[model samples]
Target: MKATWNGVTLAESDDTVVVEGNHYFPESSLKREYVSFSNHRTSCAWKGQAHYYSLFVNGEMNPDAVWYYPEPSEAAAQIKGRVAFWKGVKVEE
Candidate 1:
């Protein structure tokens, strides 16, 4: 899968974990240069707390567009070390 926003590729990986209809890409697959810190956070009853990352690509900012569970619950362990995109970011094959 490939994740893209603002006409830029945020991440691409053949190996992705699908949970709750989102494709979680490997952390290493992300193009870090286009990512920035986001203080935003959300919690999932079964997934634990999710941290966020905003996207900055081609002079546009997509705040809190990426999220991942730093320490997912055992039920969601498969998503560890992975990131998922949203807030208008497209994930496709």
Candidate 2:
């Protein structure tokens, strides 16, 4: 899968974990140069707390557009070390 936003590729990986219709790409697949820190956070009963990373690409900012569970619950362990995109970011094959 490839995650793109603002005409830039945020991440791309053939190996992905799908949960709740979102494709979680490997952390290593992310293009760190386009990533920025974000204090935003959210929780999922089964996935634990999710941390966020905003994207800065093509002179545009997409806040909290990427999220990942730093320490996911046992049931969601498969997603550990992975990140997923949303907030208008497109994930496609």
Candidate 3:
């Protein structure tokens, strides 16, 4: 899968974990130059706390458009530190 926004590829990986229809790109596959942590968070009863990231690319800023499970619950352990995109970011094959 490829995660893209603002005409930039944020991450691409052959191996992805899908939960709730969101493809979680491996943390290692992220393009760090275009990514940074955001002071945003959310909780999922089964997935644990989610940390957010801002994607900056081509003079565009997508705030908290990416999220990951830094310390996922047991049921969501597979996505620990893996990222997923939303808010107009595209994830496609």
lDDT of 1 by residue, 16-70 (tens): 9999899999999999999999999998988999999999998889899999999
Q: Tens digit of lDDT per residue, candidate 3, span 1-93?
A: 999998999899999999999999999999999987799999999999999999889998889999998889998999987999999999999
Q: Model 2 misses residue 84 by how many Å? A: 0.2
Which stretches of model 3 miss by more than 4 angstroms? none
User: Each candidate's TM vs. the true structure?
Assistant: 0.98, 0.98, 0.97
Candidate 2's C-alpha runs over 4 A off are: none
> For model 2, which pairs clash?
none
The lDDT, on a scale of 0 to 1, for candidate 2 is 0.95
For model 2, what is the alpha-carbon lDDT of residue 48? 98
Candidate achieving higher TM-score, 1 or 3: 1
- Model 2: weakest 10-residue lDDT segment is 1-10
Local error of candidate 1 at residue 92 (angstroms):
0.6
Clashes of each: 0, 0, 0
lDDT of every model, 2 decimals: 0.94, 0.95, 0.93
Full-model lDDT, candidate 3: 0.93
